[model samples]
Target: MNTKIAIIGAGPAGLMLSHLLAQKGIDSVILERRSQKDIEETVRAGVLEQGTIELMRSVGLEERMNQIGYKHEGINIQFNQERHRIDFPSLTNQEVMVYPQHEVIKDLLNARQKEGASIYFEVEEVELFDIESKTPSVEFTQYGERYSIHCDYIAGCDGFHGPSRKAIPSEQLKEYEHTYDHGWLGILAETAPASEELVYTHHPNGFALLSTRTPTLQRFYLQVDRTDHIDNWSDERIWEELRTRVDLGNGPELQEGRITSKNIVAMKSYVCETMHYGSLFLAGDAAHIVPPTGAKGMNLAMSDVQVLAQGLIEYYQDNREELLNSYEAIALRRVWKAQRFSAFMTKLLHPEQGASPYELRLQESELDYLVSSKAAQQSLAENYTGLPIEWEKGKKDTILS
Candidate 1:
């Protein structure tokens, strides 16, 4: 097979990149290891940064999301039995969309199908060769059949554990990482959300978050030991912990139902110093990962591909190399900022076990400042809704023009 670009994953980044490139009349093929049904049903992040929503709308992909997604104007922060709301619209002139990540994937996949985009699913033993060469190719198998895709560029959107990043020579890439001692035990339930807006609660027991997927489905998270197992937590025990941690005295009691799913995810912050290696460009989780506290994982991936798609479009249209050459540096600026925010949120909410009295008091004080100080709330709101995409001056106009 031959194409202009070979996208290595079918997740949001790769799919969105393919969609964007298609809009510009550029042709590309997507190679995914997971089955189509698997990707569509896998539940993930639920928050859509304002910029992400705008990008989806620009590409005619927001019709379903706009109809089903919940628009949240603010989030509540609770500490020491007190609850305060940080108004996102008042602080940043924007609001977040509470739509699951899988739904976005389904929308992108539907768009790709309508455009007749080529995507190979359930691929096995995928490999990249001659990445530094002008013409790189991806080789993989599907049900014992071997095939190779020769392309001008390859996008490693596979993920943190995928082969794309590992293909980059270890000597050329520098990785920075930090792992938390705790993790979040997340559960999805069939009940209405207790609060109209998402709530982040800090309790002596642990950190708990109250979020929603729909009017009838609620998602909740509780801080737990890193080694905790799902089998150890019964539905009753899970709800008990959540109820105790999120008690705000005056709010409605949590409405509980059968837990549909449960998983424990370790919190970590990781980023590769470079996002590109020769003709192979890394985007999304393949390049970096942020702790979920700031709700940046999916948004950052979308941001990376938006910049990448623009760079690729410029290269193919104007024969310009400046955008492509600067892709790594430009994307890294935003990537590091998100890592900082995610890390900050993780620390502010989840103190280490056996936290000293002073540490607990400091956490309370920080929450107090965030609730009382407009400037602090503004900072949180801005990062939460996402910083604007910094395209090269007039280049943004050129791309859209």
Candidate 2:
């Protein structure tokens, strides 16, 4: 089969890229190793940045989100048993939607289906070929049927472990990585949210975040050992850690109910330089990763595709290569910004194990300053709500390089 672009993976980045390209009469096919049910059911934390929400609205995919998603204009950063609210709108004229990532996936999937877009799920042995050439392609097997797609470009959205990133020669891939000692043990409970807005807590014990998935379901996280297993954290132990770290005295106790799901997400920040090789362009987790602290993962992924879609659109419609040429530099600027914010937020909330008393005091002072200073709060609010994108649609000038 011949197409303009061959997209790897069916995650947010891949699906969104396909959708955007379709809007411009550009044809692309998506190859996903997982089934549609699998991708739709994998629950993940979602904190939609303002730009993400706008992008969804622009694409006509925000209808379901508007009908069901919760909107939060503020988040509480708690310390010393006190919760301080950072009003995003008041600080930065922005707000975030507390929609789950899976829900967004469902929306994107549905939209693509309605548009008759081709997305192949449950494909095996996906591989790329001749990515450096003008004529690139992808080969994969679906249910014992071998298929090859000849396309002009390949988008490596297959995620961190997917084959796309590894397709680049190791000698050409420069990686920067920082692995933290802490991880987040998260659970989804069938209970009402304890707080109306998200709560991020820092305590001597560790860090905990309280977020709402739905009115009837609550999501909570507690900092734990990076190597800790789900077997070590029973339902009771999970609740105890959350209460110990996040409870506010003289306030409503955290609502509790049957725990439905549990996951342990390791803390790490990683960035792959250039984010592309030849005709292969990487977006989302295939390119970089951030700890979930700043809620930048999904937003960054979507942003990467937005830039990518713009580049591809220009190449197809206007015969322009400037945007496509500068895609890496453009995506990296926002990726690194997110890395900085996510790292800072992670470090600020979690006390390092075996940190010196002086170091602990300094962290406390940092929090103290953050809470007391408007400039600091605004900066945090802006980053959390997503700083503005530098790329503009249909702008031919390449300021990125």
Candidate 3:
């Protein structure tokens, strides 16, 4: 088949790219290794940067999000038993939507299904060939058959383990990475949210964040050792830790449900140069990753595709590949900004495991300044709410030597 474009992976990044390409009159196909039902039930980040919501609205995917997602203008930061609210709108004149990632996937999947778009699921052997050569193709096996799906371009929206990155020769790339000693154990419960807005709390014990999937359902996480096993923590132990960290005194009790899901997510960030190899372009987690602290991972992935979609539109319509050629730098600037933001937020909110008393005091003092000082709060608010579009413009203009 002579598809104009081929998107590997059906996650938010890949699906959104396809949708955007469709709007620009570019036909593309998406390949996913998982079935639609399996993807819809998965749980993930619930915070939507203001720009992400706007992008969804522009693409007509916001109706379900509007009806089901919760909107939060502020988030409470608690320390020393004192809760302080950082009003996002007060600082940046913007608000975020608390929409779960899975819900967004469902919306995209349903919309695509209605359009009769081609998305191959349960397909394996996904490989990228001649990415640095002319006429790149994505080879995969389905239903005991192998086929070569060719396209002018390939988008590696696949996650960390996907083939697109590895397809590029090691000699052409430089990778930078940082792995943290800490991680988070998250849970989803079938109970009403304890607070009207999200709550991020730092205690002498560790750290915890209170968020929601919907008004009637709550989602939360606790800082846990990277090697700790989920089996070690009983349901009662989970609730006890949650209560100690998230209780706002007046908030509703957190009723525990089946553990649902549990994993120790290692805090790490990665960036590699030359996100493009000939006709293949990398977008989303396939390109970079961030610790969840700043809630920037999903938004960053979405932003990459937003620029990519625009670039592909230019490529197909005006026959201009300028945007396409600069995809890596454009995406990386925002990626690094988020990486810095996530690192900053993660360090600020989680106490160093063995911090000296003086160091602890310093962290608390900084937190105090962030909450009380207008300038500090505005900086956090602006980066947290969304990044400016112009950030991509300057980065894309510089030529790679």
Clashes (N, CA, C under 3 Å) per candidate: 0, 0, 0
TM-score of each: 0.97, 0.97, 0.95
- Any idea how many clashes model 3 has? 0
Per-residue alpha-carbon lDDT of candidate 1 for residues 1-401, written as tens digits (9 for 90 to 100): 99999999999999999999999999999999999999999888679998888988999988999899999999999888888999998888899999999999999999999989999999999999999999899999999999999999999999999999999999999899998999999998999878999999998999999999888888899999988999999999998889899976776589889899999988888999768899999999999988889999899888888888988899999999888888898788888889989988889888689889999999989988899999999999998888766565333321232
* Candidate 3 positional error at 385, Å: 0.9
Each model's lDDT: 0.90, 0.90, 0.82
lDDT of 3 by residue, 1-401 (tens): 76988899999999988887887679988999988878888878868998898888988999989998888897888887788888888788998898989998988888888887899998898998888776888889888899788888999999878888888888987688998777898877777777788788888778898887765567788998877888887778888999987676776566666666666677888887668878888888887888888888789878888878878888778889887787788788888888899998888888877889998899889889888898998898888887754434554321121
Candidate 1 Cα errors over 4 Å, as ranges: 250-252, 392-401
Better of 1 and 3 by lDDT: 1
Q: After superposition, how far is residue 137 of candidate 1 from its true place, in Å?
A: 0.6
Q: Each candidate's root-mean-square deviation in Å?
A: 1.8, 2.4, 3.0
> Which TM-score value belongs to model 1?
0.97
Model 3 scores a TM of 0.95
